[model samples]
Target: MSTVYLVGAGPGDPGMLTLKAKEVIETCDVMIYDYLANADFLKWCKEDCEILYVGKKGGDHTLPQDKINELIIEKARTGKTICRLKGGDPYVFGRGGEEAEELVEAGIDFEVVPGITAGVAAPAYAGIPVTHRDHTTSVCFITGHEDPTKEKSGHNWSVYGQSNSTLVFYMGVKNLPMIAENLMKNGRAADTPVALVRWGTRCEQTSMVSTLENVAEDAAERGFKAPSIIVVGGVCSLHDKLGWFEKKPLLGQGVVVTRAREQASGMVKTMRDLGACVYEFPTISINPLENADEVEEHALQLGRWDWVIFTSVNGVKHFWQHLRNAGLDARQFGGINVAAIGPATANALRDRGINPDFVPKKYVAEHVVKGLLDLDIAGKKVLIPRARVAREILPAELTRAKCDVKVLPVYETTLAEESGAEIEKALEEGRIQYVTFTSSSTVENFFQLVKAEKVQDCPHVKMACIGPVTAKTLRDYGLTPDIQPEDYTIPGLVQSILDDK
Candidate 1:
């Protein structure tokens, strides 16, 4: 039987997408997505999956409802799995029910996947809880605009006005005056609280709160437009105390994360969720090795070494890159030593079908040296293949202890040239709220790509360096480090920012 899946794409953020929606998007041969659906969500699709954009923007749908239904049916009939991705819950204010009816008439097999609806999600993101113990127990969610072509039907606003229930209206900006008037006529208090939230989940979210009597005027003063929702009743009063999103220290500030584009995903996602605008600017690009000579040389000499050290996941990745490039397997390191400087780097080795022989309790290079010296390596060999700019402390320590150390520069760190314009633009416009320096080279290389005058433009922006070394490097650029974490991991850096905030 032909099958179709009606999936909710969540609010604007790609991270908000449901696991089922992500799974369906990956497996489906065809996908029809909404205009409000985030473009990043489409990245989950396989390389060959057919994607059709059937979005509705501001009530102007690119494809008519009937045409969308016909397309789904046609796609399913071809014996391919079909996915219909919609913004928010597929059924809430969406024409998903109507489309489902057509699918049923066409005898298509289908399933509905519910999503975090924007009506509720947006308010939560703004730190306004719809239901609180002290707040009203009942909540009403109604469309602000009925079919404009139809005669406006009168709803008894008095029931909602007299009751203590919270009232939430979707698509309500167009009928703000009428909604306020009806509430006032129906016994709603003139001073009842009201709030308008625009572009709720995304970075562009703006909100204004006022009493029911003056909400329309307040919205007008703030230039509130459609694609915004209205929340009325006493819960709207809690925004000041309960508002969390806007309270982020760097809220609305724009910062650029300069990790490699592939590796930058985690940092970019974290910063954006913390209520800051993030631009991706990769400072370094990674290229895999083309041959197995390096991997074979290290693997074949493994048994003679007392410790084999990996400092970064990229080091582990590139090592494996050479291993695969040379057609060698994990067994090549038999009886040889394995050590990782950090937990993340150690895990990378475990993921690739081998366990690290030794991992330092502390993740620093000094800790790795201490751990290695404690081992039996009086006449042993140690292989340390790492980034070119790594500190020589480890090799120097091993040699002083009378251990033979073979050092190979498997990867060279070069200044990335792609970040010139973006950093300058962000600096000139005063958009950067934070610039985190993870390594001394990253600090130096970033400034090398961008000129000295441009770097000085963002003097007031908060600067975070991962450690004392990176912090010193920032001082050379004529800026002081405002936040430096005790531990230099990415998560530690984020926690430091949160703590200082």
Candidate 2:
């Protein structure tokens, strides 16, 4: 906790993480985070960093405030950098100010990093602006329930009720009746518009609207709990008209994305955009090939081949790395035609100073072969720079066509490790609704870590494969894919899942 960084984990989306917060997280020696902090942030920590969970949810505190403060002081004495991460803004009813006072009393150096709080963000996500020129000019933020440890309450209902302002209450679900009564008794209108938004900014975000006179009763009937933001004003009336939340087909659904780690970010965002809680489980780890000299030697003799085929971006990247290491560039390819399996691979080739001569509409072995053979490569020498263990259909087909084909290994995919027990627990707890496979390797590697019976036992959990090839791999393991797109692409796969739901 030496020079502790009191950082804020923004309202739900990992994409909202600040540049400085990301830098601190990546370099911090210890991460003292809470439940509201995105679990994805943990993956950014260094392998050797120590992590402590001090989550406080509803009345369930994993570690009490006294113990957490003591733990931070103890760790700070060791001169290790500590990231004291909290949900939303540390100063926005998050008890961050209290913690900072304690740190100051202990003479610990600290820095505060602000975040997007639920107060402002939740209303916006629900299509209710806290301030409107026609409605109110000012806004008031109050804790629905004050600290019980205090000798007296700090709320002045008389002045607050008399003011013409928007009222927002944090953690107000349980105290909604008391708050409504206090405001009404102090001269505020009982029939004012009010909205309750729970788990704001997340895929599980839900909101209900009513007047202050009836919101509490309605919330009780609906069983809305704490951790909800209560917005009371004319702005609440805008929710029904401006909100598009109901259109999200995958809302509150949990999706597990299994792909190579480096390639899964965009996929994760896409799944979340569909209003699903994404669990990024990167089953495959892409690394350089063990045979560096073999790849380098092949790079020096590219002129011997009539065509060079790159099946994936990894192939293009790894092959180009060796080509540069051998003091050769794309200009060295004097007479060799370049072929890419998909647009992504073609883009990767173009990034490295080579424009692919041929790219198929469908990214499959058969389609690639059909497109290449259309260009008349009979009896030609072909070199494929690709994964160490890949489907041999392309090479085998060319060999059958009386062409010399050499499959050169450029990169390899290995299994990435995570807590299998935790994953099983998430599935058992009904937090996971879908498991996605983007490639054959991802499907194979996922089964290697997770038991087939665990997946089979969860009737609610559906398997989603990107295309027919990946689905075939899942079928080989005796599991049928519940969702597969006819277009055989990432966007199409996601759309198919939404359509199925």
Candidate 3:
């Protein structure tokens, strides 16, 4: 059955997204979203899903409201599941009701999924609770700017001023001065506390506190614009004591990740949680080798090999799947010893019910090769599962130690085909503060997508490489690494970026 789900995409932070919202988004056939919805949510969409942006910003409407309703109706009739993603509550300030009514009249099956409205969430993130027990008991949400085409104003300033309840105004920056005047005229105290939160709950969030009497003039001097929330109440006084999100150390800093799409999720989430504006520019794609059957063939002879070494996380993953394809499990590896180069690779081995017999202290080739050489497995048959193209140090060192090392190409890493416009624009404008490269492949492929000259043009955009090897690859491109951690891992790389700041 075809259904249209009206989904609330939360205010701005992607973490505020509800589990149900994520479920519907990933499974939907078409996702029709607007400017208010966070772009980060698009990553949750499954492959082959259709994404259409009808985002309306200021007076620039990508598609008229009536046309959006018609599009939803037309998509529903075509038997395709549709997800109408709106920012905050779908029913808050937009044409959500009109669209719902249109869907009802069209006899389309639909469901309404609620989201965290900005009025509540923005205030909370700003450290100003809209309804504190010490302040007003009631709260009201109002649109600061109404329809420009309306002949008459429907608002009663008297009721609003005398209500003595906390008032939150959406899209009210431009009309804040007038709103403040009207509230004071209608028996509201001129000294009432007011807070203007711009881009609330986001990395670029900024808050300004002022009294009702001088707020308008102060806003004019400070240059506050629309897309801000106007909180009017005694509750706003707590902003100085309670504001936390804006205090984040990395807030508003832009960092780009050039890892493969499959492996960048954890790194991306960590940067976002620290209040850095993260851009995922995946530069490579990991695919199984064409001779994938060779992995299964090699798994069958696991009993003959004295040792097995998995070099990368991708190596561990693909090798295990092919091992399973051969109808063999971890038990088949019975007496063969395993070695993993890094903790992540070791954990991947552990997940498949095989803990590595040896894991080096450092992920570098010298440390890993030395640790295995110290095991005194000279002349032993060692099967190494890794990418088709990788550093030869491990195997070369093993061979020198008289160990018979045979490399099994389990996976291939190829440059991904993706547009470089976003990253180019960010670098050109000096907006991106850092570009994080997790591997030599990411560094090499990143330059393939974004020109070296463009990076040279933006000296402010420093390179944060995970390890010395990746740093050397970046240096080959004529760019020096500004951040390289002593420990070669994602958490270590993130700490180095923080320390660099």
Best by the TM-score measure: 3
The digit string of per-residue lDDT tens for model 1 on 130-237 reads: 887787887888888776667766456778667787888888897999999998888888999898888887766778789989999989988999788799887888
The lDDT, on a scale of 0 to 1, for candidate 1 is 0.79
Local distance difference test scores for all models: 0.79, 0.87, 0.90
Clashing pairs in 1: none
Candidate 2 RMSD to the correct structure? 1.8
User: On lDDT, who's better, 2 or 3?
Assistant: 3
> Residue 124, candidate 1: how far off, in angstroms?
3.5
Residue 327, candidate 1: how far off, in angstroms? 11
Residue runs of model 2 more than 4 Å from their true location after superposition: none
Best of the candidates, lDDT: 3
Off by over 4 Å in 3: none
In candidate 2, which residue pairs clash?
A: none
**Candidate 3 residues 214-279, lDDT tens each?**
999988898888678999999999998998898887899999988888898899899988999999
Instruction: Name model 1 segments beyond 4 Å from true.
Output: 13-15, 59-79, 105-108, 126-137, 152-164, 201-208, 223-226, 261-273, 278-288, 317-380, 387-432, 435-487, 495-501
